[model samples]
Target: MKAAHAAWRGLEPVHGMIYFVPEARRRYAELGLSGRAGYFTSRSAAFGRASVELVVSTFYNFNPDLVRRALDGAWDVTTPQHVLDARYAAADEALRRAGLHELPALDEVVALTRRAAESACEHAQGRALFAAHAALPWPQEPVLRLWHAQTLLREFRGDGHVACLLSEGVGGLEALILHAATGEVPVDFLKASRAWPEVEWADAQQRLRERGLLDGDSLSADGVALRRHIEDRTDRLALPAYAALGDAGCERLAELASAFGRAVVRAGLLKPG
Candidate 1:
């Protein structure tokens, strides 16, 4: 189970960097998607003209208004296939620019990650976003295929995380507040990007404080325990996908994937933390 978490951390940038890289923004601009519209469209293109509500539900954070602004007429400007094509092209370019293609054991890590991703496909019954993405035809290039694999694993875990948050009665804004409390992500970044108003953010924080899960801006002891439980549950939920690899395979994948992820960071493909 620990290996599952470690593997996710290592490979996350493979999929996540696409959101920040200039290659992606350039492609989206060519498609007439301005600002963050490309992000919401490209990621949700697997749904093929998904409703704003559906995206808001599946994304499970981000202001509904923001999502609506980004997605309302996005499909009108471009087809899902076009958006998907651009997304893969951007991912390929970004990964190549990061020199991930030059990394040692590239093929081995792709095979390992794809195996885990395929294993995840078998459990896609209740995971909407993951299932939607899993339905797409696999990319032919090794680098894009690797990015696709990590994207699958990411959505697989994300859908499960949403389930965990739902079960805990945490609303979208509250979830962001909780995540911010951990200090792994900045409060301002989340608030600004998600487009949650300051008043709403404050109200959510007050709600969490009322529930004893927050003490001012940080997690209280009880809050820490709840966060821990949620994360542990999410990790456990993600374990079955990694199980197909066995402990040794998972560890090896993590080792190689982390190196690739680090290369991406060093190449400045991802934002500085």
Candidate 2:
């Protein structure tokens, strides 16, 4: 479990840097996408002009209105292939800027992560986002391939996490509120980013309090226990993907990926939280 968490922590920045880098925004701007449209469109483009409801269902935790605003008529302006190409191009430029290409043992990290991602593909029965990405052709370049591999793994884990949330009867906004209660992310940040109304946020908080999972803005003992259970279940669901690496391989991947992820953070490619 520790290895799984560590590996994800290391790889998260590797895959997540694309969203925060200027290169991604520039590419999206070239296609006339502004504000948060690039983010919503680029991530969901694999679904080929996906519906608002579909994005809401798969993204799980964003306000549906926000999803609709970003996705509506986005495909009319750009094709999914073009969006995917731009996304890959942004990742390529971002990685190059981070100097990940010059890192030691780059091939080994790529190979290990790719092996795990492929293994994840085999268990994609309930992983919509991962399965969508798995159907795409592999990138030929090592750096981009590394990004794609981590992207797959991230989405694989994300889909499983969504399932855990659903199984626990936690809705999209409730999940954000719970996460905020954990003190890892600010409630304001989650609320603003997800475009949830203040009233809805308050209502969700009240609901959580009624259920004994929250006390005011913080988690009660029951809340802490439930959050732990959700995360533990999510980790267990994500384990099959990393099982291909074995414990030793996972630890090695974690070590290598942590160095690379740190380099990316040092390069200022990732946004400050």
Candidate 3:
């Protein structure tokens, strides 16, 4: 089980870097987006083109009005399929540019990823968070299937994370505060990226401190323990997808994908944390 969890986490960067890599951002910009804001806005437009409220409700943690502002006229710039293609292309180019395009193990990773994603999709039945993505069409290309699978896996866990946070009575700002306190992301980046207001951010800090989750500017010992518990719970919730791979399969997937993930990291395709 632990190996399965590790395999999923290990492969995360291979697909997840598209959102943060500068090359990918450039690709989105080429698609008529202004910059990162346009990228996130147009990319996350996958929750159906209804209204900002619908996106905000499903997305969570992001400021509502900021979501509205970012998504304003997003569809006019690019469609979801186009955005997905560009993201995939960026990853593809980065991998190729890094000389990984011809790697022998990549195809194995893709096959394993697709299988894992299929298992996850089967398990995703009736899951509200995954329903939106599950309803989307799958690509025939092996690499694209890998990306799609990772996306579903991410959303599956993301939706679970939101549930966990909500159960703890935390919302957007508080969630950011807790994340910052955990030292996973800096407070400045959290505030700026999420467009959190100063007054509300301060209030959230006070609230976290009251909950014994914040000590000065860091997470308290108790806070660390609590956050670990939440993460562990979320991991357990996501176990079924990995379970389909079985223990040996999980280890092999991780072993095969680790090099590619490392290449992505070394190429600076992901931001330094």
Candidate 4:
């Protein structure tokens, strides 16, 4: 932000036009840290040396001692040190198996230990996890949809490339054309472009045609203009019924709506685009 503000100093002639860009919001959403009242405190900006070091320190300070005291014996500061060391030695061996030659630092080992303990606790309590995302929050579906839209909007802002935006959010071919509008028109977007099934191909094509989204099989020129216009005019949030909001303090609504839209998508609750 400081660098951006500095760069915009001389452009103050257009500084009035220096509104908050939409892409800024997507990054926060991807990290599960966008909303006002939600986020993990211990990990958020809880710095040590390197980020990996923080995890180790957190394990050494909290979970390691807790585990040893609760199961093995009474714990002093050094009580869990052996467990931490042994755990990391196993990890170092595992990494070695995967062709990663270097050993973990003491801090990294401790951090890895902490993560394993934390994950075990979560697992014991019955929680779903995706590989390493043991602590990712699942916002409401509507909230996730809004966040997903924000992510798309963010990707659309730079060089107008729309692949990531479309690939991540689009459920079918119609949304694909809409995504293509955010950038150069893609020539073969709808023709087996994504991992589409042969079964869904004819139906998707027919739907695109019936919805007036394509010229025969390709997106029409008006479709292109509409995409660009939509990208520039409204956020990809595609928020439902903000009309009730009227124009009364719309700015705050847009900001919240952007965040909410992102949450909706992140929650895997989005309606078809």
Mind giving the per-residue lDDT tens digits that candidate 2 earns over 1-273?
788779888879989988889999999989988888999999988988778888889989999999898877788888889989999999999999999999988999999999999999999998898899899999999999999999999999999999999999999999999999999987777887899999999999999999999988999999999999998999999999899999999989888878888989998997832
The parts of candidate 1 lying over 4 Å away from their true place are none
Ordered from best to worst TM-score, the candidate numbers read 1, 2, 3, 4
Every model's TM-score: 0.98, 0.98, 0.89, 0.25
- Which pairs clash in model 1? none
The weakest ten consecutive residues by lDDT in model 1 span 264-273
- Candidate 1's residue-wise lDDT over 145-188, tens digit each? 89999999999999999999999999889999999999999887
Tens-place lDDT per residue, model 3, 1-273, is 677777778778876777676667787788787744554654464555546677778768877877778777877867777776777777667656655566678678777777776777777654565767766777666556666777778887777777787777778678778788777777788888788788988888998899898899798998888888888888887777777778888899878877877876787767832
Between candidates 2 and 4, the TM-score winner: 2
Model 3 ranges with Cα > 4 A deviation: 125-129
Report the CA-based lDDT of candidate 4 relative to the real structure: 0.30
lDDT of each: 0.91, 0.91, 0.74, 0.30
